[model samples]
Target: MSGSDSDRESAKNEAIRIIATDTASVLKFYGALEPSPGEEPLPPAEIVTPEWALFRWVQVQLLMSLDVFFRYRGRVPEASALTHCWYEKIEHDFLDAEYLVLGVLEGAFATFERKLQAYWQMLRPDGVLMS
Candidate 1:
């Protein structure tokens, strides 16, 4: 491959890495909010909210698309499209419920919530236009 093609491939791989890592971190943080079956018990009130559940569900979808993207690289247009769509959903949900979600999380999981927020901000398009 030419230098330009190699650079493009590298950027694609970097994007995949960032998405996969951030998704995993968010998933782990969400998992931490839940109580294990037996050893660790949590109060009913501390359980994940419906919004969190929805967020997690969408994150899982994004992860699945990321997996397909990794397997096929840029060859599978559908996988890339799905990944972008799912990511947009996540961003929209985060922006819309930022306060509600963070308020609940800040009480007990402040550090994790902050980290998740940072990740969310990092994913934003900012000045760049996304295709």
Candidate 2:
């Protein structure tokens, strides 16, 4: 191949190498969260941490959909269609029929950081102790 063609091929190979290295580093970071026997297990889901982050980011889109629907609440057709789409995505993706609704609520139990802190503090008279 000509020198120019060889240079382009070399650059493409370097880009692939960089991407593979980055992916390996990310996988290593997530591997740290893996639990051992006798340890409290992580949540069992098909989604990984990165995937979950991406999935939860959809909440922003969900919020926008809800906002538009509320803004045009008097217009039944448009509002209904938006609401339907919102429910469809949430119910299908986040809270599917296979998973109990209570499981979702249980996940939300950790949403209140301060409340969790208070609850843990109650367990220790000194208010702070290493587990």
Candidate 3:
């Protein structure tokens, strides 16, 4: 293959690797919450640590961002426009979901609600997903 073709192939492989890595990270974050067979069931409040909450928040945000990007893929007017739109939607959805989850968990664990909200915001910085 020509040099340009070879370069394109390498870039494609790199992009695939990155996507696979992000997907694995998302799955791992969610998987940690599941109890293994014969494992004792911890209460929801006890299960979510601050660190885990932060990681979960990031993974959820990443997943939402990926969804938005994929939805707009091949149709966005410009790369920046795609990113701008994704961020707008993801940020709104993240806050909405966080509060919704907090509301559901509040009756049983009020403290968890505060911790989750804090951790979610603490980890809420700009993120980019591979196109």
Candidate 4:
């Protein structure tokens, strides 16, 4: 393959990796709750520090994004970036599933920045989380 082709393939692989990771990270809510006793619910999934909240957020986003695909019969605009022609140099009607993958991936990553922000404050001031 050409250089550009190689780069495109690399990017596609990376996107697939991230999409699988985020979707698979969706955790089940079977654990018991144990709040810090006084303060309002916090992250780590509104409980304490279980990494569950972030996963739940991603899961919800994935579900909401998929709702469009399953419920709307995939009626997206021709100008949409995530469509049959997205990942190809030449557009055709062969297996346009990459659009759904891209959508779900976008939804799954929506919580990344929020997750960072949720923990950002911990890196400063009161040092509540600082050891």
Per-residue lDDT value at 11 in model 1: 64
Instruction: Provide TM-scores for the models.
Output: 0.25, 0.20, 0.30, 0.23
Q: Count the backbone clashes (under 3 Å) in each candidate.
A: 0, 0, 0, 1
Reference-based lDDT, residue 16, model 1: 45
What tens digits encode model 2's per-residue C-alpha lDDT throughout 1-131?
23575675575445433322343433443445567888987554344442354222332223233333443442435454667676575455343212212222233222233422332232223323232
RMSD value for candidate 4? 17.5
Candidate 2 clash pair list: none
| List of clashing residue pairs for candidate 1 | none
lDDT of 2 at 29: 39
Clash count in backbone of candidate 4? 1
Whichever of 2 and 3 has more lDDT, that candidate is 3
The TM-score between candidate 4 and the true structure equals: 0.23
Regions of model 2 farther than 4 Å from truth: 1-45, 48-53, 74-131
Task: Write down the lDDT that model 1 would get.
Answer: 0.46
Ranking by lDDT: 1, 3, 2, 4
Candidate 1 residue-wise lDDT, 11-123, digit = tens: 65565455435655554545556655675653343444434544434443443455445445545455547687776765754553454244333332223344344433444
lDDT of the candidates, in the order given: 0.46, 0.37, 0.46, 0.36
Of the two candidates 2 and 4, the one with more favorable TM-score, higher being better, is 4
